[model samples]
Target: MRRLMKLGAFALVLGLLWSCQDSNEGQQPQLEEVPDEVLAQVANLGFNADEVKMYDGVLFIEGDIRITLDQLEKMSPSDGLPVEEHYHTDNLVTGTPRTINVYVQNMPQKYVDATDIAIDRYNDESLNLTFNRVSSSGQADITIRASPWYYYWFGILGSAGFPENGDPYGTILMTRGYYDNVSNINGLATTIAHEMGHCIGFRHTDYMDRSYSCGGSPDDEGDGGVGANHIPGTPTGPSANSWMLACGSPEGDRPFTADDKTALGYVY
Candidate 1:
């Protein structure tokens, strides 16, 4: 999660996200304890490299991205975030007319409906891949679940991973308990859509320097070994209204901009 924001209540950043996982276990076992050497390795691949945390056996970086040592061990680092608008990762769902099954569970009914709206946002477009909301996990190419209870207390809205092996990232974790506190169901839908973007390999529109939106020193979250290649037709520079910006405000609803549609069509 790059960060989240409170709905006009002093703007508590609910969060932003990206994720990865692997079988290379015990690379660092202590919960909540991340070693400097590991941080160095993570930094080498191009991430924030600051305040990396271990929670529930997963490495959470840049607020909500989950990455494992296995991916770091295997991936070849790519160039920094490009000075462009929408971008996609090197990995993608390669086949034509692909159906990405999405399942949402353990969340509110409003959220469930919002998921549909998010799905609709994409389905309305004419991309090679289509997102279908499945009723069960067995049929899902991507599953969205409520994050751990503590995540709500931690101000995390949602998290997801980039694509790998020509397949979409498998899961999304949305924070629980903020359903009512955060007004605007469409804003929530925006967050869900953004996570879906990640699972399908989209990077933050402001990836060149997250601080452009999140407000900090210009942090190039790096390629993190997975690759962040710029889309050919998107406008060059940060898109303030792009749904995939590194951080977002709680008050606004971020539908995909024209450039965003171009990026989706270009990559898919």
Candidate 2:
């Protein structure tokens, strides 16, 4: 009788677990269909169109390049070098010598100060493109905001949007959890600067090889047109101190390396 009772209890728990699984499966959201043009644009970027999907009104391609529905409609596809060929975007920020206003979303004063430091770094470069801090989101070209705790699971400090179709470039999403955990001011500043590189159409310096930072099989991002465009004058080999490296360390507070300056100068 004791053995029978134990088996019965185990069966009951199993049944409850199965029921919960079914309930959760029923709650799963369905993916929204994307427009053919949007798919085509993604293909032009060297991503597979079939892999494209819309969720929560945002279009995700190649596991990155978040685009809002409105931004999708406005995107103009252009032919460019693939991830293997280049590291800069064909869709660069318009208006030569334009001032890009950056706004920091309401957060800790440290984040705001960090952003200011990043801005100073760029402004000091004396490049044609300029960065300025703005108090209002309405007046800003790029809005820097914090991400929820869940974002830390991706193991990235921050992410940024690329410039598309004359849209106000893209947003910078900084992981608050990562920042709070690491109190390195220069490292945080480097993180902000790295994302800013993405906003201005720069890809990872080691776009072809993420092993140095990400520690995985070398990723070409995609062969052919989907890969990153190699900037002229930048070294073909990997750069250890590039501010645009995909991953960052708490101790790695990289200012712009010589190669980084050359690439930025050549493009912007």
Candidate 3:
């Protein structure tokens, strides 16, 4: 009986050791270090490392902004681009309330898809935003114009919305080629998001954060302003992969981040 008891105790100790080994083997892998370029992008976007968190390996980030169309329009466009003359119109000017007309000149399907995605981003209730095919006589609030080459350059360009001044914001011209490629051939969703961001009052930036990127720097008053830049959600980039700035990165694509969703909530 004493020998049997000793054997039982030895077996129990071995079982516990084996269980511990199995548990260690099943543990999730540790995260790899973030690359410097990604860190730089995160820093530029205005996110702190402490503000970023990872869940199931994906990063989540949130930002708060109070920008308006008036703020964007008052800012100047990029220098190489032609000066944009401001115009004004109202949703009630023609007795139609809250109706904003969009004329899609080329790449109709892509434009439609973009509208769908944009609406989805806004939870299917984008305010005062509507679309139609091109019309010669109908005074439209926005128009999209593009060519195959232009599409190759930038998926979409220009945007029209009711600025604070209240004139039917003029046309948002897009390169048909980029839209076609992005929609059918290339299927590049990031540029579409970027252009839509422009439509909704966002701009390009090497930085992704507003505070960290713009900290101590004078507020950017140009077309590619600081307010429109993205904010970081991960030590690597804005949320693990952001559709806004990732298109231009070595990773070559960025989906949407929580920061983007937050900004959309503000705009939509």
RMSD of each: 6.4, 11.4, 21.0
TM-score of each: 0.81, 0.71, 0.39
Error of 2 at 50 (Å): 14
Residues 33-147 of candidate 1 have per-residue lDDT tens digits of 7778778877776666775766665666666566676765565555332222366545566687899999987666877887898999999887888899989889998898876
lDDT of 2 at 56: 66
Per-candidate local distance difference test:
0.67, 0.60, 0.33
The TM-score obtained by model 1 is 0.81
Local error of candidate 1 at residue 217 (angstroms): 2.9
Between candidates 2 and 3, which one is better according to TM-score?
A: 2
Give the number of the best model, judged by TM-score: 1
In candidate 2 the C-alpha lDDT for residue 187 amounts to 71
Better of 1 and 3 by lDDT: 1
Candidate 3 Cα lDDT to native: 0.33
Best by lDDT: 1
Q: Report the C-alpha lDDT of model 2 over 1-268, residue by residue, as the tens digit.
A: 0000111123333333231111333333556788787776665555435445566677754333456777655544343422321356556777777899999997688878878888898888898888999999999889988753323332223456666654445588765544554476777777777677767766666555655555656655443353355678777766767886655464457888878887777777
Off by over 4 Å in 2: 1-44, 47-65, 68-89, 148-157, 226-230
